[model samples]
Target: MTKVLVLYYSSYGHIERLAHAVADGVRQSGASAVIKQVPELVPETVARKAGYKLNQNADVATVAELPDYDAIVIGTPTRFGNMAAQMKNFLDQCGGLWFEDRLVGKVGSVFTSTGSQHGGQESTLLSTHTVLLHLGMVVVGLPYSFKGQLRMDAITGGSPYGASTLADDGNGGDRQPSDNELEGARFQGRHVAQVAAALASANIGATL
Candidate 1:
């Protein structure tokens, strides 16, 4: 079976919810979904005080294991229009994978959450794509085929780049992903899984 890794860093609960939704979509496409998380970089005291959802239950993804996935979908909250430091730190550890070209040809995609509607959602996704491209991965993104991407009548986070969510601008953390946002996330996940499966089958046929 094609394997997909849904990896993310969620300081709060919003992106965590998005990650699971994306995983659900991956399963719908008949891919095996392995949901994992990057290790938190925050101090224990700060994490406890801020109530970070450490997600102790999810497996910690190591850079060496990245090559095992046919597809990888990553997520993070926006930090100055870029990925959070923790996610970036995790990716930084993949230098060995990059040197070996282990991630080449894998389907890579990203998602993000922001504190405000116009927050760095798209920018964050784009920035992550840059890293994926550098790793020689075949980057995938949400397309217009998902009607949710076209719905302007409602407030949501989604673009041709990747899935996103607005998590309350005032740092309230009260806002959650809207239905449209969740739909967009699922669509991206399913699309990536389907594409990865096709590529994997093609490679197998080539070998045969």
Candidate 2:
């Protein structure tokens, strides 16, 4: 079976929820989905005091296991228009993988959340894409066919870059990812997995 990894970091549960949604979408496409998270950098007491969601269910992911997946869907909360330090730190550990070209020809995608509607959501996703590209992975994104990203009916988060969600501008972390945003994530997951499955089945790398 084709395997995809939903790798993410969440401070207040927003990205965590989206990770699960993405995983569900992956499964719908008949690919195996595994959800994991980067380790928290904050000290336990500090994290608790900062109101971080300390009870996330996903296990901490190691950099070594990333190459096992045929596709990887990364999620993170934007920090000043970029991926959070925790996620960056985790990705930084993959220098060995990059040097070995271990992730080349694999599928890669990204999703993100921000504190406000215009808060660097696309910036986060796109910058992350650069990393995936450097790793020689085929990048996939949430295309317009999802429809939810095009919706102006309500305050939402999503784009051609990837699925996204908006936070409450740090107003106590009240704004959660909406159904539409979750659907966008699901769509992204399914889209990426389908592409990865096709690539895996094609075994195009074997001829190269």
**CA lDDT of each prediction against the hidden true structure:** 0.90, 0.93
Best by TM-score: 2
Which 10-residue window of candidate 2 scores lowest in summed lDDT? 199-208
Off by over 4 Å in 2: 169-173, 205-208
Model 1 lDDT per residue over 1-208, tens place = 9899999999988888899999999999988999899999999899989888765567889988999899999999999999999999999988999897888888999999999988899999999999999998889999889888777797788999999989995566488898889988899989999989998888942232
Q: Clashing residue pairs in candidate 1, if any?
A: none
lDDT for 159 (candidate 1): 90
Instruction: Report the backbone clash tally of model 2.
Output: 0
Error of 2 at 161 (Å): 0.4
TM-score of candidate 1 relative to the true fold: 0.94
Clashes of each: 0, 0
